[model samples]
Target: MKVLVTGGSGFIASWIRKELAARGHSVLVMDHQDRRQNLAPDEEFFLGDVRDATAVTEAAAHVDGIIHLAAVLGTQETISNPRPSAETNILGSLNVFEAAAQYGLPVVYAGVGNHAFRLVGTGCYTITKSAAEDLARMYNLYRDGGRITIVRPVNAYGPGQSIAKPYGTSKVRKILPALTCRALIGSPIEVYGDGTQISDCVYVEDVARAFVTALEHTAVNGPTEKPVEVGPLTSVTVNDIAAMVAGHAAAVTGRPVVDLVHLPMRPGEIPNAVVSSDTSTLQQIGMTAADFVPLAEGIRRTVDYYATQWLPGWLQGMQVSA
Candidate 1:
């Protein structure tokens, strides 16, 4: 099978590229040039912004299916610059789906969990992603010759993720305190609030695998029955995730996590955001969350990956707070 994985240079999509390649499929990766340094040898890497219809259309030409993962994904970043975020995330995604619609291919759209509910603070990012997800559904409903499945992953962490990158992070307040105890950094990790908010996380590799699986299964699209929702999904708390990261950092780096200090929570934030999956829908395709890697193992792998690959640059970018 021929497959196109958008944002293939990203931590998560990079793993998706590997998974697709390992499964004996021809893989093409479309990512921004700035992120190409980590491009693996097996992928036919294409460097171009998704905002360009010609570029995405050209990339889409070679693949039988699409896994759309490219987006400007972060609340602070998107909120700070909503226009560009909307252009890249919402408009750019439409281009991808448009090409797929033109080419008659099935598409798996990456949707955000936060958009499942109304959150006040991160409205900019949530609204944009939610709109993009709708675009996929609308295309699937009316367009000819393709299927669309919206996969909303909560807080996914794994080998390719970086805690240091500013785009996305669990909104738990105690993470910094836990990081301070681990001495993972020279300064305290930033905390936004009281650290008790709950969230869920999935493993990136698992998510990537699901992306491929969604394509392989025919039930993901149909007129005979409802769409099949692929699985390997799990929901976990932000505080629990922070503690796990802290403990993992301690064991790997030999430091203890300190207690998180109280801080003002971000405005318009959801105290708890969880997603509902149609388990029966997923099981029809022989997918389940049981295949997911447990949080402890996933965290250990994530901490180790960040420590080796992303932490040096992350730590270097930090300045001591005056």
Candidate 2:
């Protein structure tokens, strides 16, 4: 199949593109960046944003299926600039759905952490993702024969994950990037609000494979209202993550042991962000425990990436804290 992948230049979609090629498929990517390196001969790029309906339609055309990964990402980033977030996450999703319905193409969408057990948070990112999920379900309902499978992945981390870059009105705050920035230099890892807030994180490759498997299987399963939860079986608190990354930094790079410094919780943040108790779709796709990179191994890999690829540039730009 030749798939149209929205947000194709983003971290997660980059992996999805690789998975597609591995599965004997080609991809046409629509994103803000041009990611031309190492693409399959048939794989193509459409440099555009999902917010542009005309561009989305143009990119959506002639694809066998659609993998909708584009969105205004980040909890705090979206909350800080709600208008653009709404335009992209909500309206951009609508454009994709409409195009899919018009073309009678199957859709595999990216959702936030599972809501089957409990909602992850009550921020703009959570609200907009939920709204988009609702819109997806509605599209499946109204459009006869329209199929849409949603994958709800927890905080995804791995090699290609970028550091906190300018995203919307606020800069992004990814756990691994921030922790890595400090841990690599033997500086204190900042932990907000006693560091007890829980989060379930998945490797980017595993998340990508989950999306590919869902796309390959959705035809057999049909569009289920219940999203496929993708992530680890275990949940870790912020404190746990801090310690693990710190240990990896020391072992992986000979960095000194790091400590955690507690800070006030950011506004609109949730205490716990975990996966649902329901059977994760990774299981449904027949991925055994062996398929997942163990948390330690994953962190070690991420640490290596930062220690080599990231830290060199980051060190040059890093301003000394006053």
Candidate 3:
């Protein structure tokens, strides 16, 4: 299989590229970002944006399928100025689908779980992604030879996550675990409102694997068959995840973590958001959500990754006090 992974240099897409290449498939990594260290030697790399239909079409000319992962992320980034958000996510997705249709290639869209449910905040991102998902379904129904699969990922996290980055709605769920670790390490952990909001977190590796499975199981003949949802189906609360993060940190540091309550809930925050995916399709296709990495273990691994790979620069940039 020859696969094209957009935004291949990003946190999740990078892993997807590696996974595809490891499975004996040829991969073409396309991204506008100047992040070269993420690609493998075998990947045909192209520095490009998805918003350009001509570029996308040219890139899709020879690929068997596409893993569409490029999008304007970060709720704050998107909602602040909808023009850029609309142009990148919505328009970018259309280009991918149109190019797929033109070249008769299968497509598996990487839609965000944060946008899967209605929320009070992050309107910009949710709006564009919602539009994108609708386009995916539309392509499935109308486009000939265009198989469209949608994977709604709930709070994917693991190594390569930057704690210092913006906490957009897609990233807010991460606050629980991040603050928990802070507390365990005797640092102040902030919480918005009473920290009772409910959500779910999955590992990035699991999400990346789901994309691969969907691409492999794509129906070449029937474009309307929606491949069943893949990845974790369990839900956890913000408080629950926070406590778990603190527990693991305590175990690692040999000290009790601190809980620091902070400002009120952000405007438009969802009180409770959970996902109920029918995993029968994914399982029948020989993929298991249980293969999804456990959140607790994933948190520990993520923390270790930050410490080893990014802690020095993070501490220096953030000015963590002793």
For model 1, the local distance difference test gives 0.66
* Model 1, C-alpha of 119: deviation from truth (Å): 6.7
Which ranking of candidates, highest TM-score first?
Answer: 2, 3, 1
Clashes within 3 Å, all models in order: 7, 0, 4
Compute the lDDT of residue 195 as modeled in candidate 1.
56
lDDT for model 2 comes to 0.79
Q: Which ranges in model 2 have alpha carbons more than 4 Å from their true place?
A: 33-41, 114-121, 165-170, 272-277, 288-290, 316-322
Q: What is the lDDT of residue 186 in candidate 1?
A: 30
Candidate 2 backbone collisions, by pair:
none
Question: What TM-score against the true fold does each predicted structure earn?
Answer: 0.82, 0.90, 0.87
> Candidate 1 lDDT, tens digit per residue, 1-322?
7888887776668777888888898877788765656656666778888899999999989888888888876565555667977898898998998998888877777777667564444657788888887787788778886477776665555654434324225332223233422345533444446455656566778777776777776334442133444333454455556667666676666656634444565644655544434445555446777777876777777677667765665555554422
Between 2 and 3, whose TM-score is larger?
A: 2
Question: How does model 2 score by TM-score?
Answer: 0.90
Tens digits of lDDT, candidate 3, 119-236: 4455677788878988988887877856788776667777765454232213423553466446544676766666666667778888778888778867443332544565465667
Candidates in order: C-alpha RMSD to true structure: 4.4, 3.2, 3.3
In terms of lDDT, which candidate is strongest? Answer: 2
How do the residues 53-161 of candidate 2 rate in per-residue lDDT, one tens digit apiece? 8888888786888899998876666667788778888999999988888787888999878443325445677788778989899888887757898888888899977
lDDT of 3: 0.72
